[model samples]
Target: MPDKDAGTPRVFLVRHGETEWTISGRYTGRSDIPLTPDGEHQVSSSAGVIVGPGRIIDPSKITHLFISPRTRARRTYELLFDESAQKMIEGKSETTEDIREWEYGAYEGLLTAHIRAARKERGLDKERPWNIWVDGCEEGESADEVSNRLDSIIAKIREIQGPYMHGEKGADVVLIAHGHILRAFAKRWIGFPLSTSLPMMLEPGAVGVLSYEHHKVDEPAFLLGVNMGGSR
Candidate 1:
Protein backbone atom coordinates (compact mmCIF):
# COMPACT_ATOMS: atom_id res chain seq x y z
CA MET A 1 0.00 0.00 0.00
CA PRO A 2 1.20 3.50 -0.73
CA ASP A 3 2.01 5.68 2.29
CA LYS A 4 -0.83 8.07 3.06
CA ASP A 5 1.24 10.41 5.21
CA ALA A 6 4.04 12.10 3.37
CA GLY A 7 3.84 14.47 6.32
CA THR A 8 3.04 12.38 9.41
CA PRO A 9 -0.68 11.86 9.79
CA ARG A 10 -1.90 13.62 12.92
CA VAL A 11 -3.79 11.13 15.11
CA PHE A 12 -6.79 12.19 17.15
CA LEU A 13 -8.50 9.48 19.19
CA VAL A 14 -12.00 10.21 20.50
CA ARG A 15 -13.60 8.21 23.28
CA HIS A 16 -17.31 7.56 22.90
CA GLY A 17 -20.00 9.35 24.87
CA GLU A 18 -21.52 8.20 28.16
CA THR A 19 -23.35 4.96 28.90
CA GLU A 20 -25.46 4.20 31.96
CA TRP A 21 -22.72 2.00 33.33
CA THR A 22 -20.12 4.65 32.65
CA ILE A 23 -21.93 7.26 34.72
CA SER A 24 -22.07 4.76 37.57
CA GLY A 25 -18.38 3.83 37.31
CA ARG A 26 -19.09 0.20 36.60
CA TYR A 27 -16.71 -2.08 34.80
CA THR A 28 -18.04 -2.24 31.25
CA GLY A 29 -16.45 -4.92 29.14
CA ARG A 30 -17.71 -6.51 25.94
CA SER A 31 -21.25 -5.86 27.11
CA ASP A 32 -22.46 -3.78 24.15
CA ILE A 33 -24.01 -0.80 25.92
CA PRO A 34 -25.75 1.99 24.07
CA LEU A 35 -25.29 5.68 24.74
CA THR A 36 -27.73 7.58 26.87
CA PRO A 37 -29.61 10.62 25.50
CA ASP A 38 -26.94 12.82 27.08
CA GLY A 39 -24.20 10.77 25.48
CA GLU A 40 -25.71 11.30 22.06
CA HIS A 41 -25.75 15.04 22.64
CA GLN A 42 -22.24 15.01 24.01
CA VAL A 43 -20.82 13.34 20.93
CA SER A 44 -22.79 15.54 18.61
CA SER A 45 -21.61 18.79 20.13
CA SER A 46 -18.03 17.86 20.99
CA ALA A 47 -17.40 16.06 17.71
CA GLY A 48 -17.17 19.40 15.98
CA VAL A 49 -14.10 20.13 18.04
CA ILE A 50 -12.42 17.72 15.70
CA VAL A 51 -14.09 18.60 12.41
CA GLY A 52 -16.62 21.41 12.62
CA PRO A 53 -16.37 25.04 13.67
CA GLY A 54 -13.17 24.54 15.63
CA ARG A 55 -12.03 23.47 12.19
CA ILE A 56 -8.92 22.18 13.89
CA ILE A 57 -9.59 19.10 11.79
CA ASP A 58 -11.15 18.68 8.39
CA PRO A 59 -13.45 15.69 8.11
CA SER A 60 -12.46 15.08 4.52
CA LYS A 61 -8.79 15.09 5.42
CA ILE A 62 -9.14 12.03 7.61
CA THR A 63 -7.88 8.94 5.84
CA HIS A 64 -9.45 6.61 8.34
CA LEU A 65 -12.00 6.89 11.15
CA PHE A 66 -11.33 3.71 13.10
CA ILE A 67 -14.25 2.73 15.29
CA SER A 68 -14.81 -0.16 17.59
CA PRO A 69 -17.35 -2.68 16.37
CA ARG A 70 -19.00 -2.16 19.74
CA THR A 71 -22.36 -0.48 19.40
CA ARG A 72 -21.48 2.50 21.56
CA ALA A 73 -18.60 3.51 19.34
CA ARG A 74 -20.56 2.96 16.15
CA ARG A 75 -23.59 4.77 17.52
CA THR A 76 -21.46 7.74 18.54
CA TYR A 77 -20.00 7.94 15.05
CA GLU A 78 -23.43 7.74 13.50
CA LEU A 79 -24.89 10.43 15.73
CA LEU A 80 -21.87 12.70 15.43
CA PHE A 81 -22.42 13.17 11.73
CA ASP A 82 -25.43 14.35 9.83
CA GLU A 83 -26.96 12.05 7.19
CA SER A 84 -24.60 13.02 4.38
CA ALA A 85 -21.59 13.41 6.61
CA GLN A 86 -22.31 10.10 8.33
CA LYS A 87 -22.11 8.41 4.95
CA MET A 88 -18.49 9.50 4.50
CA ILE A 89 -17.22 7.89 7.68
CA GLU A 90 -19.85 5.17 7.87
CA GLY A 91 -18.33 3.64 4.76
CA LYS A 92 -14.76 4.31 5.84
CA SER A 93 -14.95 3.58 9.58
CA GLU A 94 -12.96 0.47 10.32
CA THR A 95 -14.11 -2.10 12.85
CA THR A 96 -11.27 -2.71 15.25
CA GLU A 97 -11.63 -5.30 17.98
CA ASP A 98 -8.48 -3.96 19.60
CA ILE A 99 -10.21 -0.68 20.20
CA ARG A 100 -12.80 -2.40 22.38
CA GLU A 101 -12.89 -1.62 26.12
CA TRP A 102 -11.28 -3.64 28.87
CA GLU A 103 -12.94 -6.96 29.57
CA TYR A 104 -14.68 -6.96 32.98
CA GLY A 105 -15.41 -10.66 32.94
CA ALA A 106 -17.42 -11.83 36.00
CA TYR A 107 -17.45 -8.28 37.22
CA GLU A 108 -18.72 -6.71 34.04
CA GLY A 109 -21.37 -4.08 34.70
CA LEU A 110 -20.88 -4.34 38.46
CA LEU A 111 -20.23 -0.97 40.04
CA THR A 112 -16.80 -0.55 41.61
CA ALA A 113 -18.14 -0.54 45.15
CA HIS A 114 -20.18 -3.66 44.51
CA ILE A 115 -17.19 -5.39 42.96
CA ARG A 116 -15.06 -4.39 45.91
CA ALA A 117 -17.62 -5.88 48.27
CA ALA A 118 -17.72 -9.07 46.26
CA ARG A 119 -13.96 -9.20 46.05
CA LYS A 120 -13.70 -8.83 49.80
CA GLU A 121 -16.17 -11.65 50.23
CA ARG A 122 -14.12 -13.79 47.89
CA GLY A 123 -10.87 -12.96 49.69
CA LEU A 124 -9.37 -11.66 46.47
CA ASP A 125 -7.83 -8.49 47.79
CA LYS A 126 -5.92 -6.00 45.65
CA GLU A 127 -4.23 -8.84 43.88
CA ARG A 128 -6.32 -10.53 41.22
CA PRO A 129 -6.02 -14.33 40.95
CA TRP A 130 -4.96 -14.26 37.35
CA ASN A 131 -3.47 -11.19 35.70
CA ILE A 132 -6.20 -8.60 36.28
CA TRP A 133 -4.53 -6.56 33.65
CA VAL A 134 -5.10 -9.37 31.13
CA ASP A 135 -7.79 -11.64 32.52
CA GLY A 136 -10.22 -8.95 33.59
CA CYS A 137 -13.17 -10.59 31.88
CA GLU A 138 -15.10 -13.56 33.31
CA GLU A 139 -12.24 -15.32 31.64
CA GLY A 140 -11.45 -12.23 29.64
CA GLU A 141 -8.64 -9.75 29.27
CA SER A 142 -6.83 -7.57 31.79
CA ALA A 143 -5.29 -4.11 31.56
CA ASP A 144 -1.91 -5.39 30.37
CA GLU A 145 -3.66 -7.92 28.18
CA VAL A 146 -5.70 -5.27 26.46
CA SER A 147 -2.70 -3.01 26.06
CA ASN A 148 -0.79 -5.72 24.26
CA ARG A 149 -3.82 -6.45 22.14
CA LEU A 150 -3.80 -2.83 21.03
CA ASP A 151 -0.21 -3.23 19.87
CA SER A 152 -1.22 -4.51 16.47
CA ILE A 153 -3.67 -1.68 16.01
CA ILE A 154 -1.00 0.82 16.95
CA ALA A 155 1.48 -0.83 14.62
CA LYS A 156 -1.06 -0.77 11.84
CA ILE A 157 -1.42 2.96 12.39
CA ARG A 158 2.33 3.41 12.22
CA GLU A 159 2.45 1.32 9.07
CA ILE A 160 -0.17 3.58 7.55
CA GLN A 161 2.11 6.54 8.22
CA GLY A 162 5.18 4.91 6.82
CA PRO A 163 5.75 3.81 3.23
CA TYR A 164 1.97 3.39 3.22
CA MET A 165 0.91 6.95 3.88
CA HIS A 166 4.02 8.26 2.20
CA GLY A 167 7.08 7.14 4.12
CA GLU A 168 7.52 7.37 7.88
CA LYS A 169 4.82 9.99 8.29
CA GLY A 170 1.98 9.00 10.61
CA ALA A 171 -1.64 9.48 9.54
CA ASP A 172 -4.58 10.69 11.53
CA VAL A 173 -6.18 7.57 13.11
CA VAL A 174 -9.31 8.73 14.96
CA LEU A 175 -10.60 5.99 17.21
CA ILE A 176 -14.02 6.04 18.80
CA ALA A 177 -14.14 3.51 21.61
CA HIS A 178 -14.79 3.02 25.34
CA GLY A 179 -13.02 4.51 28.34
CA HIS A 180 -10.75 1.91 29.95
CA ILE A 181 -9.21 0.94 26.65
CA LEU A 182 -8.56 4.55 25.76
CA ARG A 183 -6.76 5.14 29.05
CA ALA A 184 -4.79 1.98 28.45
CA PHE A 185 -3.95 3.28 24.98
CA ALA A 186 -2.45 6.44 26.38
CA LYS A 187 -0.52 4.54 29.06
CA ARG A 188 0.96 1.94 26.73
CA TRP A 189 1.77 4.45 24.02
CA ILE A 190 3.99 6.20 26.50
CA GLY A 191 5.70 2.91 27.51
CA PHE A 192 4.50 3.24 31.09
CA PRO A 193 3.82 0.21 33.23
CA LEU A 194 0.24 -0.99 33.08
CA SER A 195 -0.05 -0.02 36.74
CA THR A 196 0.50 3.48 35.49
CA SER A 197 -2.79 3.15 33.68
CA LEU A 198 -4.36 3.63 37.10
CA PRO A 199 -3.32 7.23 37.48
CA MET A 200 -5.04 8.52 34.37
CA MET A 201 -8.78 8.17 33.96
CA LEU A 202 -10.56 9.21 30.77
CA GLU A 203 -14.20 10.21 30.90
CA PRO A 204 -16.69 9.61 28.15
CA GLY A 205 -16.63 11.86 25.08
CA ALA A 206 -13.15 13.05 25.94
CA VAL A 207 -10.78 14.02 23.15
CA GLY A 208 -7.23 12.73 23.45
CA VAL A 209 -4.68 13.55 20.81
CA LEU A 210 -1.44 11.49 20.77
CA SER A 211 1.29 12.47 18.38
CA TYR A 212 4.92 11.58 17.91
CA GLU A 213 6.82 14.54 16.62
CA HIS A 214 9.98 12.83 17.82
CA HIS A 215 12.20 10.92 15.44
CA LYS A 216 12.02 7.67 17.41
CA VAL A 217 9.54 5.82 19.60
CA ASP A 218 12.04 5.91 22.45
CA GLU A 219 11.73 9.62 22.20
CA PRO A 220 8.79 11.08 24.10
CA ALA A 221 5.64 11.55 22.04
CA PHE A 222 4.35 14.79 23.41
CA LEU A 223 0.90 14.51 24.98
CA LEU A 224 -0.13 17.13 22.41
CA GLY A 225 -3.50 17.25 24.14
CA VAL A 226 -4.98 15.09 26.87
CA ASN A 227 -8.49 14.70 28.17
CA MET A 228 -9.87 17.91 26.74
CA GLY A 229 -13.31 19.03 28.05
CA GLY A 230 -16.40 17.31 26.68
CA SER A 231 -19.84 18.36 25.40
CA ARG A 232 -21.32 18.07 28.82
Candidate 2:
Protein backbone atom coordinates (compact mmCIF):
# COMPACT_ATOMS: atom_id res chain seq x y z
CA MET A 1 0.00 0.00 0.00
CA PRO A 2 2.97 2.27 0.24
CA ASP A 3 3.58 4.42 -2.83
CA LYS A 4 6.92 3.96 -4.55
CA ASP A 5 8.83 5.58 -7.49
CA ALA A 6 6.73 6.65 -10.49
CA GLY A 7 6.65 4.08 -13.29
CA THR A 8 4.26 2.48 -15.70
CA PRO A 9 1.52 0.72 -13.80
CA ARG A 10 1.02 -2.93 -14.76
CA VAL A 11 -1.73 -5.50 -14.50
CA PHE A 12 -0.62 -9.11 -14.25
CA LEU A 13 -2.96 -11.67 -15.76
CA VAL A 14 -2.52 -15.15 -14.30
CA ARG A 15 -4.38 -18.13 -15.76
CA HIS A 16 -5.24 -20.67 -13.11
CA GLY A 17 -3.30 -23.94 -12.95
CA GLU A 18 -4.38 -27.19 -14.60
CA THR A 19 -7.66 -28.87 -13.76
CA GLU A 20 -9.31 -32.07 -15.00
CA TRP A 21 -11.29 -30.15 -17.58
CA THR A 22 -8.26 -28.15 -18.59
CA ILE A 23 -6.31 -31.33 -19.35
CA SER A 24 -9.25 -32.80 -21.23
CA GLY A 25 -9.94 -29.55 -23.13
CA ARG A 26 -13.50 -29.21 -21.91
CA TYR A 27 -15.32 -25.93 -21.46
CA THR A 28 -15.01 -25.23 -17.71
CA GLY A 29 -16.90 -22.02 -17.30
CA ARG A 30 -18.41 -21.38 -13.85
CA SER A 31 -17.38 -24.84 -12.72
CA ASP A 32 -15.89 -25.15 -9.25
CA ILE A 33 -13.16 -27.61 -10.09
CA PRO A 34 -10.00 -27.97 -7.99
CA LEU A 35 -6.46 -27.97 -9.29
CA THR A 36 -4.65 -31.25 -10.03
CA PRO A 37 -1.66 -32.31 -7.97
CA ASP A 38 0.78 -31.29 -10.73
CA GLY A 39 -1.09 -28.04 -11.05
CA GLU A 40 -0.62 -27.35 -7.35
CA HIS A 41 3.06 -28.07 -7.62
CA GLN A 42 3.40 -25.89 -10.71
CA VAL A 43 2.09 -22.80 -8.95
CA SER A 44 3.79 -23.48 -5.64
CA SER A 45 7.12 -23.69 -7.40
CA SER A 46 6.51 -20.39 -9.16
CA ALA A 47 5.78 -18.47 -5.94
CA GLY A 48 9.31 -18.31 -4.64
CA VAL A 49 11.02 -17.49 -7.92
CA ILE A 50 8.69 -15.05 -9.63
CA VAL A 51 7.11 -13.11 -6.76
CA GLY A 52 10.00 -11.88 -4.66
CA PRO A 53 12.33 -8.89 -4.89
CA GLY A 54 13.98 -8.19 -8.29
CA ARG A 55 11.59 -10.67 -9.85
CA ILE A 56 8.82 -10.38 -12.38
CA ILE A 57 6.30 -9.52 -9.69
CA ASP A 58 7.64 -7.80 -6.58
CA PRO A 59 5.32 -8.78 -3.72
CA SER A 60 5.61 -5.38 -2.08
CA LYS A 61 4.45 -3.65 -5.26
CA ILE A 62 1.16 -5.51 -5.63
CA THR A 63 -1.52 -3.13 -4.33
CA HIS A 64 -4.58 -5.23 -5.09
CA LEU A 65 -5.60 -8.64 -6.39
CA PHE A 66 -8.82 -9.68 -8.14
CA ILE A 67 -9.62 -13.40 -8.10
CA SER A 68 -12.29 -15.39 -9.83
CA PRO A 69 -14.97 -16.96 -7.66
CA ARG A 70 -14.17 -20.44 -8.95
CA THR A 71 -12.32 -22.96 -6.79
CA ARG A 72 -9.62 -23.48 -9.41
CA ALA A 73 -8.68 -19.83 -9.55
CA ARG A 74 -8.83 -19.34 -5.81
CA ARG A 75 -6.62 -22.38 -5.23
CA THR A 76 -4.18 -21.16 -7.84
CA TYR A 77 -3.91 -17.83 -6.03
CA GLU A 78 -3.29 -19.59 -2.76
CA LEU A 79 -0.52 -21.76 -4.22
CA LEU A 80 1.14 -18.88 -6.02
CA PHE A 81 1.73 -16.83 -2.86
CA ASP A 82 3.37 -18.19 0.24
CA GLU A 83 2.09 -17.84 3.81
CA SER A 84 3.64 -14.44 4.68
CA ALA A 85 2.78 -12.94 1.31
CA GLN A 86 -0.75 -14.19 1.74
CA LYS A 87 -0.89 -12.44 5.11
CA MET A 88 0.26 -9.18 3.52
CA ILE A 89 -2.63 -9.45 1.06
CA GLU A 90 -5.19 -10.77 3.52
CA GLY A 91 -7.46 -7.76 3.13
CA LYS A 92 -6.32 -6.75 -0.34
CA SER A 93 -7.91 -9.53 -2.38
CA GLU A 94 -11.45 -9.58 -3.66
CA THR A 95 -13.24 -12.54 -5.20
CA THR A 96 -15.31 -11.23 -8.09
CA GLU A 97 -17.80 -12.71 -10.53
CA ASP A 98 -16.46 -10.39 -13.19
CA ILE A 99 -13.16 -12.24 -13.11
CA ARG A 100 -14.77 -15.64 -13.45
CA GLU A 101 -14.32 -17.81 -16.53
CA TRP A 102 -16.28 -17.07 -19.68
CA GLU A 103 -19.71 -18.61 -19.18
CA TYR A 104 -19.94 -21.68 -21.43
CA GLY A 105 -23.65 -22.24 -20.71
CA ALA A 106 -24.99 -25.12 -22.82
CA TYR A 107 -21.49 -26.05 -23.81
CA GLU A 108 -20.21 -26.14 -20.22
CA GLY A 109 -18.75 -29.64 -20.13
CA LEU A 110 -18.29 -30.18 -23.85
CA LEU A 111 -14.95 -30.21 -25.59
CA THR A 112 -14.30 -27.96 -28.60
CA ALA A 113 -14.33 -30.81 -31.08
CA HIS A 114 -17.46 -32.28 -29.56
CA ILE A 115 -19.22 -28.95 -29.73
CA ARG A 116 -18.18 -28.53 -33.33
CA ALA A 117 -19.36 -32.00 -34.24
CA ALA A 118 -22.66 -31.39 -32.50
CA ARG A 119 -23.06 -28.11 -34.35
CA LYS A 120 -22.46 -29.82 -37.66
CA GLU A 121 -24.96 -32.55 -36.87
CA ARG A 122 -27.51 -29.90 -35.95
CA GLY A 123 -26.76 -28.08 -39.22
CA LEU A 124 -25.25 -25.09 -37.43
CA ASP A 125 -21.80 -24.75 -39.02
CA LYS A 126 -21.15 -27.40 -41.66
CA GLU A 127 -18.74 -25.49 -43.82
CA ARG A 128 -16.27 -23.77 -41.48
CA PRO A 129 -14.95 -24.17 -37.95
CA TRP A 130 -16.78 -22.79 -34.93
CA ASN A 131 -14.74 -19.93 -33.60
CA ILE A 132 -15.59 -18.77 -30.09
CA TRP A 133 -14.73 -15.18 -30.94
CA VAL A 134 -17.26 -15.26 -33.76
CA ASP A 135 -19.74 -18.07 -33.07
CA GLY A 136 -19.44 -17.94 -29.23
CA CYS A 137 -21.19 -20.56 -27.08
CA GLU A 138 -24.71 -21.74 -27.88
CA GLU A 139 -26.26 -20.21 -24.73
CA GLY A 140 -23.34 -18.42 -23.20
CA GLU A 141 -21.96 -14.87 -23.43
CA SER A 142 -21.32 -13.09 -26.70
CA ALA A 143 -18.11 -11.39 -27.68
CA ASP A 144 -19.61 -7.95 -27.14
CA GLU A 145 -20.82 -8.79 -23.65
CA VAL A 146 -17.45 -10.18 -22.67
CA SER A 147 -15.76 -7.09 -24.04
CA ASN A 148 -18.03 -4.78 -22.07
CA ARG A 149 -17.47 -6.53 -18.75
CA LEU A 150 -13.71 -6.63 -19.23
CA ASP A 151 -13.68 -2.96 -20.20
CA SER A 152 -15.49 -2.08 -17.00
CA ILE A 153 -12.92 -4.01 -14.99
CA ILE A 154 -10.10 -2.23 -16.82
CA ALA A 155 -11.64 1.14 -16.02
CA LYS A 156 -11.77 0.25 -12.35
CA ILE A 157 -8.09 -0.75 -12.44
CA ARG A 158 -7.13 2.56 -14.00
CA GLU A 159 -9.13 4.40 -11.40
CA ILE A 160 -6.90 2.82 -8.75
CA GLN A 161 -3.59 3.13 -10.62
CA GLY A 162 -4.05 6.53 -12.32
CA PRO A 163 -2.77 8.60 -9.46
CA TYR A 164 0.39 6.50 -9.04
CA MET A 165 1.40 6.38 -12.71
CA HIS A 166 2.66 9.95 -12.78
CA GLY A 167 4.56 9.71 -9.52
CA GLU A 168 7.98 8.06 -9.08
CA LYS A 169 6.53 4.52 -8.87
CA GLY A 170 3.51 2.70 -10.29
CA ALA A 171 0.91 0.35 -8.85
CA ASP A 172 0.36 -3.28 -9.75
CA VAL A 173 -2.94 -5.10 -9.94
CA VAL A 174 -3.07 -8.90 -10.17
CA LEU A 175 -5.85 -11.00 -11.65
CA ILE A 176 -6.27 -14.74 -11.03
CA ALA A 177 -8.75 -16.32 -13.44
CA HIS A 178 -9.32 -18.79 -16.23
CA GLY A 179 -7.75 -19.12 -19.67
CA HIS A 180 -10.32 -17.65 -22.06
CA ILE A 181 -11.37 -14.75 -19.85
CA LEU A 182 -7.76 -13.81 -19.16
CA ARG A 183 -6.99 -13.74 -22.89
CA ALA A 184 -10.08 -11.72 -23.58
CA PHE A 185 -9.14 -9.35 -20.78
CA ALA A 186 -5.71 -8.85 -22.30
CA LYS A 187 -7.18 -8.31 -25.77
CA ARG A 188 -9.47 -5.59 -24.45
CA TRP A 189 -6.73 -4.15 -22.26
CA ILE A 190 -4.87 -2.95 -25.37
CA GLY A 191 -8.10 -1.56 -26.97
CA PHE A 192 -8.19 -4.34 -29.55
CA PRO A 193 -11.32 -6.04 -30.75
CA LEU A 194 -11.86 -9.57 -29.51
CA SER A 195 -11.09 -10.84 -33.01
CA THR A 196 -7.59 -9.44 -33.25
CA SER A 197 -5.49 -10.77 -36.13
CA LEU A 198 -2.81 -11.86 -33.66
CA PRO A 199 -4.01 -14.33 -31.06
CA MET A 200 -2.77 -14.65 -27.48
CA MET A 201 -2.32 -17.96 -25.69
CA LEU A 202 -1.61 -18.66 -22.02
CA GLU A 203 -0.62 -22.03 -20.62
CA PRO A 204 -1.77 -23.37 -17.30
CA GLY A 205 0.13 -21.80 -14.41
CA ALA A 206 1.41 -19.05 -16.69
CA VAL A 207 1.62 -15.26 -16.19
CA GLY A 208 1.29 -12.44 -18.67
CA VAL A 209 1.93 -8.74 -18.11
CA LEU A 210 -0.02 -5.78 -19.45
CA SER A 211 1.18 -2.21 -19.13
CA TYR A 212 1.39 1.13 -20.91
CA GLU A 213 4.14 1.96 -23.35
CA HIS A 214 6.25 5.04 -22.69
CA HIS A 215 4.65 5.37 -19.26
CA LYS A 216 1.45 6.78 -20.80
CA VAL A 217 -1.79 5.17 -19.72
CA ASP A 218 -3.30 5.75 -23.15
CA GLU A 219 -0.60 3.65 -24.78
CA PRO A 220 -1.42 0.18 -23.56
CA ALA A 221 0.59 -2.78 -24.79
CA PHE A 222 1.54 -6.36 -23.87
CA LEU A 223 5.04 -7.26 -22.85
CA LEU A 224 5.48 -9.74 -25.69
CA GLY A 225 8.24 -12.41 -25.73
CA VAL A 226 9.62 -11.27 -22.40
CA ASN A 227 9.74 -14.37 -20.21
CA MET A 228 8.75 -13.65 -16.61
CA GLY A 229 10.35 -17.01 -15.74
CA GLY A 230 9.45 -19.51 -12.97
CA SER A 231 6.13 -20.41 -14.58
CA ARG A 232 5.27 -23.64 -16.29
Evaluate model 2: give its TM-score: 0.91
- Model 1 residue 101 lDDT score: 78
User: Residue-wise lDDT of candidate 1 within 84-183, one digit each (tens)?
Assistant: 6665555657887878877777877787677667766877666743345543655667565777787777777666654433323224568788777777
Scored against the true structure, residue 232 in model 1 reaches a CA lDDT of 8
Model 2 clash tally? 5
- Whose lDDT is greatest here? 2
TM-score of each model, in listed order? 0.79, 0.91
Candidate 2 ranges with C-alpha deviation above 4 Å: 1-6, 166-170, 225-232
Candidate 1 Cα lDDT to native: 0.66
lDDT of 2 by residue, 8-76 (tens): 677899988889988999999987889999888778777766886656776667788999999989898
Could you tell me the lDDT of residue 187 within candidate 1? Answer: 70
